[model samples]
Target: MHEKTIAELAAALQAREVSSVELTEHYLRRIETLDDALNGYITVTAEQALEAARAADEARAQGRAGPLTGVPVAHKDIFCTEGVRTSCGSRMLDNFVAPYDAGVVERFKAAGCPVLGKTNMDEFAMGSSNETSYYGPVKNPWDTERVPGGSSGGSAAVVAARLAPGATGTDTGGSIRQPAALTGITGLKPTYGRVSRWGMVAFASSLDQGGPMARTAEDCALLLNVMAGFDRRDSTSLERPGEDFTTALDRPVKGLRVGLPKPFFGEGMAPAVARVLEEAIDHYRGLGVEFREVDLPNAGLAVPAYYVVAPAECSSNLARFDGVRYGYRCEDPRDLLDLYTRSRGEGFGAEVQRRIMVGTYALSAGYFDAYYLKAQKIRRLIADDFARAFQEVDVLLGPTTPDTAFRLGEKTDDPVSMYLSDIYTIAVNLAGLPGMSLPAGLADGLPVGMQLIGNYFDEARLLGMAHQYQMGTEWHRMAPGGFN
Candidate 1:
């Protein structure tokens, strides 16, 4: 029961082959049995999940169930879940129970999906590896010794381990897609503002976009259909009409124009990843898709530019967590300054503190032009490069990460090495385009993912492209040993 994909589970539920409570209990049991090792979840709402499952059963009996009714889903802790502790994987908010549901959470609830719980993440979504999580790092299901890519690693872990059929993840510098690659699942980072950010704790306000993580492109489509939409409450939310992303899954891939960024194939990629990606490209070529080398010349600069832009924004967004209104407050302080300093110093983890400091430095008065301003110019150039490439190709393809998942603690001491893990992915976020990671194959016993990047608001085509590949192969269906 726990091994089923979301679409299969939804069908079984509608056909009355299984009750919602029973399905929910099966997953709750899996979490109970497996989560101690994975640490994928920060909070488990078994009681609420069962309650919601019961409600879903009632809805189904009355013939009012939607496609997602009674399906279980997990939220990244960054989203504010009313009445639940929305910790954001930071100690500062460990005790903070949100007063309302984030737009994504609310939409899933409206679709009758039971909330599995909030998953762990990097402290304030700061790190590439999940090790920086305040709750503790999320271990990849494929190999427990390795890190499950970041910020959204916990979300990916839960989905990969079959603890949840699908889960929500946010990408700021490849948080969602990277983990999906490492964990051997599918993840989509939608176009910026494609999903509402209202009530979601801001990471890089300009870079953070929420999307779905699941086993297959079909499941991601189902989840994305629920996640993307216009939200009046969010100033940045696009006002596009609701879309059914699943509708395009069966579209033919023949003659589809796929771009291969020259820099992507030129250098920096591990041999194992390159080998698998080449095989993946051949798979697409066999399907009659045309591939051409396109130049995203400024893509190589994305890392430096993103570090400047994201951290600068991180510094500003994280300023709200001071000891004044809520979150952690120091026990005793000589003055307001002491209170602020002490609370933040003690509450945030080392990585979060490091980023805040760097961000502050980048956004500082004199350095603004030299660092932040220059980085923005580079960001514009990266976006322009992608825009020009899109004019020639319907979508672009590349390695999701430079390589497969690294062992835990391997790159922790060297921040640059850790930062480079997202080298290929940072450009898409900077450009605010939709990108997805689907398993290409395994490398060194770990998953190697191939990324598909679509033009702005072209998420449906991206899903279709991936679905076409998934249909030809079983990579997405392969589960980690013992996880099933």
Candidate 2:
């Protein structure tokens, strides 16, 4: 039961082969048994999950169930859940229990999917490696000693380890796709405004977009159908009509034009990872997919540009967490200035502080034009490059990361190198385009992911292409040894 995909589990629930309670308990047990080593989840809502499962079973018996009636799923800690802790993987919010459900959480509830718990993530979604998480870094299920890419590492790890069938994740730069690639899972980041940001903890507001993480594109499609909807509370939410993301899963990829950016194939990529990518391209070519070489001249500037733009936005959004209203507070205040300084200093981790300082400096009066404005200009150039490529090709393809998951603590000492871990993915966020990562193959026994970038609001086409490729390969089905 734990091994079934969301679609398979939905079918079993509809067939009455298993009750929602039984399915929920199966996962709860697995999480209880296996999660100690992985630290994938920050909180386990067993009581609430069981109650929700019972209600779903009752709804099914009365023939009032939805398509995802009994599916069990986990939420990234960044999302607010009413009466549950939404830590955002920080000490500041460790004791902060949300008073309301995030927009995505509400949608999943409406679809009758039981929430298993909240998963761990980087401190305020600021790190590439999950090591900055206050709860503890999430270990990759594939190799326990290695890191699972962040800040969606916990979400990706849970699904990869089969603790949950699917989970919600937010992508600021490469949070979803990078971790998915490292852990051998399917992750999608929809176009910027396609999903609501209401109740999701802010992390670079302009770049953060929540999406789905699961084992297959079909499962991600089902989750996306529920997650992608407009919410009046979120000003950034798109007012577009609802979409059935699964509609294009079986669409043929014959004659589909795939663009391979020359910059992504240049120096810096590991030879093993490049080999796996080449093999995936060969497989796609055999499927009648057409490949074309393209150039993203400014793509090399994505990392430096993202560091400025994202931190600037994060500085503005995170201003609400000062010692006044809620969240962690320092001991008896010496004064207003001391209260503010000590509270924040004690609440946030080192990485979060580093970003806050960098952002403050960039947005400072003397440096605004020099740093923030320049980064925004570079951002436009990157977007224009993607626009040009899209005019010539249907989709852009590249390696998700420079290499497979690295060992924990390998790059934590060098923040520059850590930031570059997202070199291939940050530009998509800058352009506000939809991007996805699908398991292509293994390199040195570690999973490698192929990124698929689509035109604005073209998630369906990306899912269609990934699903078609998955149908011809079993890479997505591979699991960690002990987990299987």
**Per-residue error (Å), model 1, residue 447:** 0.7
- For candidate 1, give the lDDT of residue 272: 93
- Name model 1 segments beyond 4 Å from true: none
Count of clashes in candidate 1: 0
Clashing pairs in 2: none
The models' CA-based lDDT, in order, is 0.93, 0.95
lDDT of 2 by residue, 1-484 (tens): 8778899999999999999999999999999999998999999999999999999999999999999998999999999999999999999999999999999999999999999999999999999889999999999999999999999999999999999999999999999999999999999999999888999999898899999999999999999999998899988889999999999999999999999999999998999989999999999999999999999999999999999998898888888888898898999998999888999999999999889889999999999999999999999999999999999999999999999999999999999999999999999999999999999999988999999999999999999999999999999999998898
Q: For candidate 2, what's the RMSD?
A: 0.6
lDDT, candidate 1, equals: 0.93
User: RMSD to native for every prediction?
Assistant: 0.7, 0.6
Q: List the residue pairs that clash in candidate 1.
A: none
Candidate 2 has an lDDT of 0.95
